[model samples]
Target: MLTRTFLHFPQVGERRERALWRFGFCDWHAIVRSVAPSPWRHLWDEWQREAEASLEAYEVGNAAYFAMRLPKSAWWRAIPDFVHRAVFLDVETDGTHRITVLGIADSEGYRAFVRGQDNFDEARERLESAKMLVTYGGSHFDLPVLRANFPDWQLPPLHLDLCPLLRRLGLRGGLKAVERQVGLSRSPQTDGLNGWDAVHLWWRYVDGGDERALQTLLCYNREDVMPLPTLLALAYERLWAQTLKASQQTFLPMMGSKERRTG
Candidate 1:
């Protein structure tokens, strides 16, 4: 998907990108090999250099390079490519918007960092190590709270916020709502619980020393993170199909060795 992206090129918008795809310049290699005389021909050499640099950055696991170049909405294009180091994150906050639990899940499993019980430094460390971050509404909510709490900490290089992305796909509403729409379900223990419930659970644990409350909160957070990968996988397929339809592409071609090396 990253190779199929042309929006990173200068003066290229959605219209131009679709036009390029329709013109059979469907990937980086296609664009690099374009030989027909055109106004953009002068920039071909520069584009090739940039593409090579991007490929190098990808090979080195430098997700920030693509994050800086591509629009946030396009970050999904880089997800499958960087999924080896991708992590899903979600945060539980109190009424004051102070974070109580910071949960992160990778391919291994889920881990929760409670404000009082666990060291947030570990959360920061985990986040920093991730090449990509997948979150539902993290861009507007979870991430802002994290930035406020960890002022000096660096977030994952690529953040794929599914909130707007799913919205763009006509799947509006919150995480659980979208989940149900897409046939994802939660366990009975964590099902139906929402953010307010998380906040109350945290207070119950903090004020009344109710260990069960903390455990439940952690379970809720776990549920939140676990379904993200499935959701992202679904989105990628749906969007790819949409892109192919829009570009009138019947099938994907074999990418050249240089282009294949990056992924």
Candidate 2:
């Protein structure tokens, strides 16, 4: 999708990029390698330099460049081919202001980050280094809560908040509801848990020292994050199928269930 994107450069609006496309200047590499024609030749050298710099920035894992280059709508397509640098995020909080637990998954696997029981620094490190973030409702819930929790923390450059995207496909309501529509059924142990149940689990753990409650809470939290990548991938395919150009559209495999669960 990044290769198909022509939005990174200055002086190249949709109309101008269409001109380039007609002249066979289809992609960044094509533009850089071809000799520019008369009218645009004077600016070509500078554009080439910026293009190389942008590609280099991506190669070096410099996500800030992308933050500046891409519009939010294009973020989904711009996700890199390799997803190891991406993280799936979800949080379970007390009904009020406290975050009871968070589950984050990356290429390595998913784990629950429980308050007091674990260090946040490790989760913070993975979140900071991730290039993309996949979440069900992180934009409205998790992200704002996290920002309030840690004012200085920075999220990854690209975020695909699936709640709205799925809504685009007429899949409405909550995460569990969306999962059912998409055939991502939860396991029996965690199937019926909700945010309120999560709060109960936390209170039982903290007030009564019920270890079972904590484990169940973690299971619930883990379940919240585990299906994000697949859901996000499906959202991408369903929503983009109508809009993506023929040259840009291709079947992208969902991340392996093994990597998603274990990683």
Q: Which prediction has the highest lDDT against the true structure?
A: 1
RMSD of each: 3.0, 4.4
Residue 256 of model 2, lDDT score: 36
Q: Which ten residues in a row have the lowest lDDT in candidate 2?
A: 254-263
State model 1's lDDT: 0.80
Error of 1 at 128 (Å): 0.7
> Which residue ranges in model 2 land beyond 4 Å of their true spot?
11-23, 35-49, 245-263
Cα-based TM-score, every candidate: 0.90, 0.82
List ranges where model 1 is wrong by over 4 Å: 33-36, 251-263
Clashing pairs in 1: none
lDDT tens string, model 2, 1-263? 45445667777665665566566665667767878798789889877887787667756666667667877766665544435678999988888767889789998899888898899989889998887888887788998888878778878877888888788779998999999998889888889889899999899999999999998888888889988888877876765564435224343223332311101
**Ten contiguous residues with the weakest lDDT in model 1:** 253-262
